[model samples]
Each structure stands twice: as structure tokens, then as C-alpha cells.
Target: MTPRRVTVVGAGVIGLSVAHELARAGDRVTVVADRTAADSVSAVAAAVWFPYRAGASPSMPRWLARSLIRFAELAEDPGTGVDLREGTVVERAPGADRSWTAAVPAAREALPAELPPGALSGVRATVPVITGSQYLPWLAARCAALGVGFSPRTVPAVDELAGSADLVVVAAGLRSGELLDDDSLFPVRGQVVRVANPGITDWLTDDEHPEGLTYVVARRADVVCGGVAEVGSWELAVDPAVEASILARTAALVPALAGQPVLSRAVGLRPGRESIRLEHVPGDAVPVIACYGHGGAGVTLSWGCAEAVADLAGAGLAGAG
Candidate 1:
């Protein structure tokens, strides 16, 4: 059998995550991207293990469970350079969203009243949240160490991947509009204000359990931050009004964040689709797999999705090709 060298498009979290998995499997990997992976939307995502909020999907909870288990494995390996930590996710108004808590029974726990006014119900556990800026650079470096190449050139179409790589994996995130030719794909704009603080401890999540879902997360670097999910928004430019709204919602959930010196503000798009695109297409005889439309869940779902992609690619290479 001839050795298969794989070309992965889009170095975002999902693409890189797939590359990492494949590299571990001893496949030759090359990552092609126009912009640096760290600058992509995957970097902008405030990674959380929280999967779809129940009613959000039928199989999401199951997929999340599988991904989370994988996340812990990858995060525990310092070689992967993941920023995994323990966090307490609270569902407002307590008794609400029990079904979601039940989905991940490992999360539910008792919280003291002093924590928040509407602290209805909660769950506490350690999970991995990849700092995109840190993790992507680490992944790229590791892939390079394994003899994988990084091409700064942009692939405009699946055919363009021919001869560039033996096998093609399209992980372009949202930019797949050109290659995949689906302009219906758009960005779900979000703003996150990271604040450096020594006081804000504990990884927290504001899942709309009871009252409403609004929350903040603490970075390994001690930046307690908050974010927003504004859909169909193309504006990468952070609006003053949206920034204020994000800060206001954050403060409302965690008072300690109020009056604290803000460190910085960032905006990134969460590529969305009615359904996630993860399918194999033929690219001029080179195998092509498209893995996009992660929406806001890419951070949480990347691990599992990568595994799924690798498994599919392995089948494709095993004959019947």
C-alpha cells in the first residue's frame, strides 16, 4: 500500500485537532490556511464543555459525553498544551434544567447562597478549556515536529487540494464558503471581555437552567471573562454597545467582575449551519472531508468530531477507494 500524505485545510481548532489525531496515527499531515489559525474564529471561541442545552438536540448530549471524555484525555497530556481546569456550572433559578444536569449528572452539586441570588441548581467538575491562542500554536508546532508541513497558501476549492496533498481534509470553519460553495454559511458574532484578576476563582458557566442563561469563565491566565451569542452578525468589529452589554450581563452574574480592571476585548465569529458539515467528497481523486459548521460548540465538540473524521478517513484509505 502506498503511504498516504494528508492535507488539512483551515488550521482552526477543528482542523488542527484533526491533524493532531491523524499525526498521532502516523499519517503525514500538512495544514493549509490563508490566515493564521490563532486568528480564526476557533481562537475567538470561549471554549466550554457545555454541549447543546437539552431540547437543543436529540443526540447532542450523547456526543458531548463522548467528546468530554476525550477532552479530559487530551487535556491531561501536557504535550498537547491544553488548559484544562475544574469548573462549576450553575443553572439559574436552581431547580430548572434538571434534564440537562441529568444528562451530565456529574455536574450537579449544591451551591451556597452567597454565590449568587438566583443560584438555583449547579454542577461542579474539572473539564478542559483550550486557550485557542496557546493550543493552536502548540498543535502547529507538534505537527511540524512530526514532519507535517504548514502551507500559508489558501485553497480556493476542493480541486485545488489535488497534488497539493495526497488526501484532503477541509476544516475551513466558516471560510468554506468559497471551497464548499455554500454562502448560506454565516458568522454568529460574539464579544468577550477578558479581565485579569486574582480574586475571581473557579470555572463557572451560566447555563439557562432556570431563570436565564448568562455567565462567565476564568482563563488559566486569571482572566475572568464573559461572552455573547449574537446570530447572523457579520460585524467582526466589536461595537461599543455590544461590549457594554456583554460586560453588563457578566457583572450581573458575577459581581466580583464588576469594577475590576478589564484587560482586553475581542470579537470572533462562530461559523454556523443548520447542521454540521462533516462529509467525504472526492477532490480530483484525492479524498476530501468537510468539517465545518461547528457554531459555538466547536471548542467542546472538536475532540469528538476529529475522532469521527479520522475514523472516516481511515475507512476511505482501507480500500473501496
Candidate 2:
């Protein structure tokens, strides 16, 4: 197959994934973004693999399963910054979203001992927990090794790349809507506090916490304590009250995180939409593939969505030919 020139916008997990896949498929790929992967919001993600706030779609299950398989495979190599860790999802209400468990064979009902206080039920499963600090850089390096070139710049619109590349992928995360003129995209604000690990390895999530969504994800370097999802919030300032509340809630859930010296705190705006947009855009000057609006599942759904994007890009190129 002749290599088609492809430009992917954004350097977050989704964009880098698409660039990697396309380059691997013999496409001359270039990633154009305003920021590097380490500087993007994906770097700030707690990055535990579950379909948290994922779009409701029939394809969600396939994406989840494919991503799970890929992450498990990557976990075999330490350089990938992927870890398959056992964890518990605390359910405080009846009939919470257990849809993710279907993709996980080892997922099962947690024993009473596993349940945190004030939890109605829980699911114990081994899922991929990504250390973004390592993973993002690793992914970008992998893309580079595959001959995927990167252009660091602010792209005002996808049309700007029409003359330069044969195909364009819009994976600009929060800024995707502005580029595509699709107002459906919005920011779901998330804040997390990183702390020194206290010899804890297992992870825990309590989305049903009455105060806010709480989770403790222990990676190789630090334990990520997070967070709250605020819809339509664009504030980047770290809130002291929110940090205190997060520490209190996470410590109450795990207890081990108590008094752990703070490493750092970060706030990120997850690109949220009614459903993820991962399809071809018809009637454009350049054949455009839309693959943004992954919300918090950008890391969770990265590999799977990238494969889908590559397939769509292939089809588009074939048709163009």
C-alpha cells in the first residue's frame, strides 16, 4: 500500500494512539498539536482503566474489550507504563453501572471485607492503571520510532491542514469542538492530588461517594487521589478546599494515604460529549476523520479507538484513491 499523508491534531493519548496506528499501517503520519503529550491533560489523568463517564453506545463494549486486551499485553513490558492491578469499585447504590465488568473475565463481586464503609456492593477486578508521566512520553517515543513526525503548533481549524496532508484526524480533546464547529463538545473538569506512595499497590474507586467521586490509584511512583467531575467548568486553578476534601475522602476510603506527603496537584478538563465521535466527516476539502470526545476514557479506550481510526482512515484513503 502506498503511504498516505495523515495529520492528526492533538498530542493527548487519543491523538498519539491514532498517529501510532496510522504510522504503523504505512501512513506518513504527522501529529500537529499546541502542546506535547506530557503537557496535555492526559498527563494529569488518574488513568485507571474503567469506562468512567464513557459515552453510551453499542460499540462501547468492543472498544473496552479491545483496549483491555491491548493494555494487558503492554503490561508484560515495564517500558509501556501499563500495569494490570487488582482493585475494587465501591458501589454505594443499587444497580450502578457494572457494564465494564462484562469485558473483564476476572471481575466478580467483592467480599464484605473488600467493601469500604457505606458501600452497598463492590466489584473486584484487575484493570489497567496507567502512569501518564511515563506512558505519554513512552507512547510519543514509540510513535517517533515508527516515523510519526510531530508538529508543535496551535491549529485553529482542521482546514488549515487540507493542503498539507491527504487525511486529517481531529483528536484535539477539549478544543475539538471549536475546530470542528461542533458545540456538543464540552469540558468535564477533573482534579487530582498526587501523593507519595505508602507501600500501597492496589487501587480503589468510589464513584458513588455522596461528597464527590473518589478514587485512589497507586502507580509505580505515586498514588493518585482524585477527584470530582464538574460539568461545564473551565477553571484551571487548584482549589485548596477541593484538595482537602479529596484527601479526606480518599484517606477515609484507603486509610493508608493519610498523612502521605503531597507530591503535586493538577486540574484537567476532560473532553466530554454525549457520545464519542469516532467516524469520518463527509464533504470536506480534505478527507477528515473525527476521533475526539473521549472524556475521561481517553486512556481506557486509546488502543481500540486508534485501531478504529486507522481502519476508517484506510477506508477513506482507499476511496480517495
Candidate 3:
């Protein structure tokens, strides 16, 4: 196949992953973004492998399964910042959708004693936890080594790259809709606190927490405590009350977080939509592929979506021939 010039918009996990795959498939890929990985919303993610707020879709199972396999392989590389960790998901309701367990065979019903106070049941599983502080840089470095070029700039429209590239990938996350002139996209605001990890290695999540979404993800350097999933919220500033509530709830769940010194606070606007957008849109000066609206599952679904994007791009290349 003849190599095609591809311009990928956005440098978050989705875009970077897409670039890596496309470049590996012999496409000359250039990544254009307004923010680097460290500044992108992906940086604020608690980054555990589980899907959150991504909604139920038939494709989710395949995407999740593919991502798990890739992450498990990446975990072997210490620089990748991906780790296989044992964790628990506390449920407040009985017979909750354990369908996600299909992707993680190790997942099993938690024992009665394993349920935290006020929890009806739980699931224990071994999953990948990514430390974005380290993982993003590692991903970018890998992409760079693959000869993917980086352009630090904002693209106002997908057509802007028509003259320079044969294809444009709109993986711009929350701002993607604006570039495509589509309004179906919105943000699900998430707030999180990064604190010193006090030797705790396991992770826990209680999405049904009465106070709101609460999760504690421990990494090599720090533990990521989060968060609130406020739909339709665009606020980016850190809310003092929200931070306090997150610390209190997470500490109550693990106890070890009671007095940990806070290292930082972050807020990310997760790109939310009724469903994820990962299809090719023709009729543009340059053929455009839409690949955003992943919501909070951007990282969880990244590899699977990237592989799919590369397939779409390759199909387009073949058609042009």
C-alpha cells in the first residue's frame, strides 16, 4: 500500500494512539494539537482501565477486551506506567451489570466481608491502572520514535488540512464538535485530587457512592482520588468544596487517605455524547474520520478505537488506489 499523509487533530490519548497505529501502518502522520499530553484532559484522568460513563454499546465489549490485552502487554515496560493491579468495585445495588466482567475473566463477586459499609455487593478484579503523569509521555515518546511528527497548534476546522494531507482524523476530544460543526458533543466535568500515596497499592471505585463518584487509584508516585461526574458542566476551576468532599469520601473508603498531604487538584471536561463517534465522514476536501466523544472512557477504549481508526484509514487508502 502507498503511504498517505495523515494529519491527526488532538494529542490526547486517542489521538496519540491513532497516530502510533497509523504511522506503524506506513502512513506519514502528523499530530496537531493546542495542548501537549501533560496539558490535555487525559492528564487529569484517574486512568484506571475500567470503563466509566462511556455508556453501554455492543462495541464496548470488544473495545474493552482489546484494550485490556494491549495494556497487559504494555505493563511489562516500566517506563509505560501501566500496571496490573488487583482492585474492587463496590456496588450499592444488587444484580448490577456485571457484563463488564466478560472482558476481565479474573473478575468475581466479592465476598460479603469485602463489601464496604453501605455497599450491597462488589466485584474484585485485576485490571490495568495507568499513571497519566508517566504514561502520556511514554506514549508520545513511542509515537515520536515511530516517526510521527508533532505540530503544536489548534485546528479551527477539519478542512484546514486539506492542502497538506490526504486524510484528517478528528480526535480532538471535547472540542471536536466545534471543528466538525456538530453540536451533539458536550462535557461531563470530573474533578480529582492527587495526594501522596501512603504505601497503599490496591485501587477501589464506588460509582454508586451516595456522595458522588469516588475512586482511589494508587500509582508509583502518588494516589489519584476522584471524582464527580457532573453532566453538562463546563466549569474548569477547582472547587474547594468538591475537593474536600472527594478527600473525605475516599479517605473513608480506604482510611489510609485520612491525612495524606494533597499534591495537586485537577479538573477535566470529559467529552460526552450519547455514543462515541468513530466513523469516516466523506465529502470533505480531504476525507475526514471522526473519532471522539469517548467521554470518560477515552483511555479505556483508546487502543481499540485506534486500531479501528487505522483500519478505516487503510480502507480509504485502498479505495483511492
Candidate 4:
């Protein structure tokens, strides 16, 4: 029997991951995208394992847990651009959601010294931190090794692939809802500044920072300092004022980075929706697996979402067979 032909839309971490999982499952996978991982919002992400700005989903726990496990496994190989690092999630309020802790068994309440100034509480855990510049290309190479093909082109519609593809997986980030005509989708704008790493290895996130959402993530090459989550904003240009504020905030969080040379600045519009859509589209001429709307947790949730998409594709293929 000929292997099933699967066309995946988008080449970000999520799309590449879905392609890898499906191809590994013996499908003929082809990834179609206008932006590869390096140009996609995934590249702009601090790429930590924390679930930031992801809306509620019934499968969130499972997805987070599975992704954490996969990233931990990937970290064993440095070439994969994944690292297991310790971090603190600074809490400003007493009743902040601790639901994510269920997925991270090693998570524990931080000591007073671990907490930043004025922090009400904090959680410390060692989690995966992905360096996208390295991880994206590595993922694409791994997918190619698994016999997955890539097409550098725009996919205007999912219907266009119905004739040649046995199944279509839509992972098109911000453009997914437009392709599928789902108006519930929106863009959550995020901005970050990359600075020279001053030998910092640990990461810190202050979601409840009085000024804005602040985080400091140390990668192998550079330290990522950010950010601001602007809802319903689509502007991609870097804002000078925002950048200054980010620099100041991050400096206060990690003093060593105060005088560090600026490396780069980036702005990305994260695909936001009420919840992630990862299911079969009903009544379509072709079998379509909808797997987009990851928001800021795209990297945090990629592998788990990919596995779920693969499972859906497998079930769909078996039914068709």
C-alpha cells in the first residue's frame, strides 16, 4: 500500500513538528509555508517551557506534560538547540494559577532570596529552553531525514491540496483562521530584545511585573529580554519606547545585563484564540486536521500538539483505508 500523503501548512516549530511526527509514523509529508521557522514567530519567542498567554484548553495539561518530556529528551543532544535550565516564575499575587505545576513535578515554591523585589511568591523549576536559531534548522533537518519534503510557497486555501494530499494539516499560525474562515482568531503582539549574554544561564519570568510582562532568558549565544503582550495588535515594527522600557525592566531583573550590548530586537504577532484548535474539520472534501492558535506557548506546546495531530492523522487515514 502506498503511504498516505500529508500536506502541512506553515513551517514554524508547530508545523515542522507535526510534519516530523507524521513522517516518522510512515506518512509522506510535505510542509508548505511562506515563512520558515527562522522567520516565523516561533523564532522570536524566548522559547521557554512555561505556558504564557495560552488560553484554556481541556487537553492543556496533557500537551504541556508531553512537550516537557519531549524537550527534556531532546536536551540530551546539544545539537538539538534545547537545554534543560533552571528558572523562576515570579508571582505578584497570592492566587495566581498554579495549574501548570501539575505538569512539572520538580516545581517548588521559591525561597525568599530567590524571589525578586516586591514579588509575592515564586516557583522554581528546571525546564527546557529552546534556542530557535539552532532548533528550527535542526528540526527541519530531522524532518527531511525522515523523508518529509518542504515547499517554500504560500497556501491560499486548504482545498488546493485536496487533490494531491491524502490529509491536510493546517498549522499556519496567525494566518490559520483566515484560511479556515474562523473569525475567533486574533493576534497577540509580542516584542523582545536580544542582548549579549553576560554569562547568565538561569531564566526568570515576571508575568505580574507592575510595568509589563518581563522575562530574562539566557540562551547559549545571547540572552533574551522581554516583553509586552498587546492584545489585538498587529503592528510588527519595533517600538523605540517599548524597547527602552524592556531594557530598563530587564536590567532591574538581572543587573549583569544592564550594560550589555544590544544584539537584536524582534516583534511577532502570536496567533491567539479562545483555545487551541486541534481536531478534524467537519464536512470538508478532504480530511483536514486543524492545529493552530498556540499563542505565546507555541514552543512550550509544540511536540505535544504535534503528537496529537499525528494521532488524529493516523486515525483519519485508517478510517479512509
Q: Who wins the TM-score comparison?
A: 4
Worst 10 residues of 3 by lDDT: 312-321
lDDT of each: 0.71, 0.91, 0.92, 0.93
Task: Quote the lDDT for 256 in model 4.
Answer: 96
Point out where model 1 deviates above 4 Å.
Answer: 52-63, 77-84, 92-105, 110-115, 207-213, 282-285
Query: What value does the lDDT take at residue 90 in candidate 1?
Result: 67
- How close is every model to the real structure, measured as TM-score? 0.86, 0.98, 0.98, 0.99
lDDT of 2 by residue, 1-321 (tens): 567899999999999999999999999999999899888999999989988887887789889999999999999999989999999999999888888888999899999999987999999999999999988989999999999998999987778788999899999998888878789988899999999999998999998899999999999989999998999999999999999999999999889899999999999999999899998887668888899888889999999999999888777666564
Q: What is the lDDT of residue 54 in candidate 2?
A: 72
Among the numbered candidates, top lDDT falls to 4
lDDT of 1 at 164: 58
Give the clashing residue pairs of candidate 4, or none.
Answer: none
lDDT of 3 by residue, 1-321 (tens): 557899999999999999999999999999999999899999999989888878667788988999999999999989899999988999998778887789999798899887789999999999999999899999999999999999999887777799999899999999998888889998999999999999988899999999899999998889999999999999999999999999999999999889999999999999999889888987778889999999889999999899989988888777465
Off by over 4 Å in 4: none
lDDT for model 1, on a 0 to 1 scale?
0.71
Model 3, which residues run further than 4 Å from truth?
A: none
For every candidate, C-alpha RMSD to the true structure in Å: 3.2, 1.0, 1.0, 0.8
Clashes of each: 4, 0, 0, 0
Task: State the RMSD for candidate 1.
Answer: 3.2
Model 4 C-alpha RMSD vs. true structure (Å) is 0.8
